[model samples]
Target: MAETILVTGATGTVGSELVRALINRGVNTRAAVHSIIKGDRLRHFNPEVQLVEVDYHRPASLPLAFTGVDRVFLLTPFSDQQLIINQQLVDAAKAAGVQQVVRLSAAGADMEPGIQLGRWHRQMEQYLEQSGLSHVILRPTSFMQNFVNYQGQSIREQGAIYLPLGEGRMSYIDAFDIAEVAAAILTDDVAKHHGQAYTLTGPQAVNHTEIAGIIGQATGRPVQYVDVPETAARQAMQGAPQWMVDSMMELNALGKAGHLAGTTPAVEQLTGRPPRSFQEFAQEHRHELMPA
Candidate 1:
């Protein structure tokens, strides 16, 4: 029988794609979602994907979620209790006889406290490292799908993309590529994979204005880029909590000053394919942005 790998945050961007890649390689995937309602789509996406209710906030669900699972992919919704939730996952993974674990962390996942996600993810990485399970930490840069969130309702009405990030360059990585890398690490046992973290980014660096230009051209619409102040950016975000506001602003400030603009071939090296360019991403989803 094939080993079963349990994936947390199964309905999320990377988790959704990660599950597919694992199943393609003949790995049995069990998706631990917060609720059965969210797991329906993942089950439809993969016949082999088994959905189970595993709420991280309530650590009680984790043991049941990890039952008979050999490998685990952990993802914490970045927030105040991230460290605590991650610790719970580590304990549960260890208790449930899990052998390998993969973590989806943010860029700059080091112990240093320069960035919020960095500090939190580093703590989680350290906990998993000493948890007696083989682990791979994926520190991916700014997600390109963050742009997709803007296209949802407000930006479609306003014909513009708003951000606190001015003309700062960043290698915005594709979430699918991140997932592909995560899937590879979870399945294989390369020496370099253990006790190591990989920083994943796109092939090239570009600014928010350039992203706007791509979106404008791709959709044949007049799209504008407006650099709002951090205060305004926070107010503009719908349903954004106070913590998310702080993190988003910090990331924007960091990117605007060119602090997160590292290009890498690691994604391609691990996945055996180049990360998707903004042009390709735009072309594939142009219809969604410009529905007539």
Candidate 2:
């Protein structure tokens, strides 16, 4: 019997890329998405990807999504709904006779509620362990693509970046690399990785000022870093919805305490290559980092 793997958050930045890698490998892929529109968009890679709409708030819809799937790629949306969503998936996965789950979790997920997202992911990781399912937790640090976020404003209008991070070093991993690792775990019988947790990070820990200098060199503009109070930074994002506002603030607080500096050999161990550097990420998406 051919085993099937259902990937949640298939429309998201990481899941979307994993879906492609699975298709290229010819894995029996199941895309569990929040919207049919998103699933349909992903069908471009291969019509073999079975698309199913799954809202974890409604767990009844999940058993059907999990039917005939041997493994699952569980990615809880990083929002208010993460805990309930993870709980629902765990319950449904147990009920559906699923074999394994590769959870997309946050870095520094210790038992003591670490931070906002970190806390919830730790809770979910515990729940999955208690559920007795074969599981592998992939905890990745900050994402390099987030720098693309500041590109528009910094390159286009701001001509500089204002963040609370100051010179705090961070090991920002690439989303695509994270997704590839997820796909590898799902398709392999490498039992060594099961019941284990992996932490992924970029090749180097660099500061925001260094990032500014890198962008300045890449874009032919003098980009400077302006550090502000965390309160002021949160206030600057007042237009962001409550969940995002709270999440970013909690993350910055974690950064100030020196959490994001953690690095690992897990990326190369799994993918057989060193994780992408900030410079490589910046160069590949320079257009996104530069103002139009």
Off by over 4 Å in 2: 111-113, 149-151, 239-244
Error of 1 at 224 (Å): 1.1
Q: Can you give the TM-score per candidate against the true fold?
A: 0.94, 0.92
Encode model 1's per-residue lDDT on 47-110: one tens digit a residue. Answer: 7679899877678888899999998999987668888998998899989888888888888777
TM-score of 2: 0.92
Q: Candidate 1: deviation at residue 205, Å?
A: 0.8
For model 1, the local distance difference test gives 0.83
Query: Number of clashes in model 2?
Result: 0
TM-score, candidate number 1:
0.94
lDDT of each: 0.83, 0.84
lDDT of 2 by residue, 123-241 (tens): 89999989988899999998877777544566557767777986788898989899888888888884767789999898888888888887777777777888889889988898888
Alpha carbon lDDT at 272, candidate 1: 95
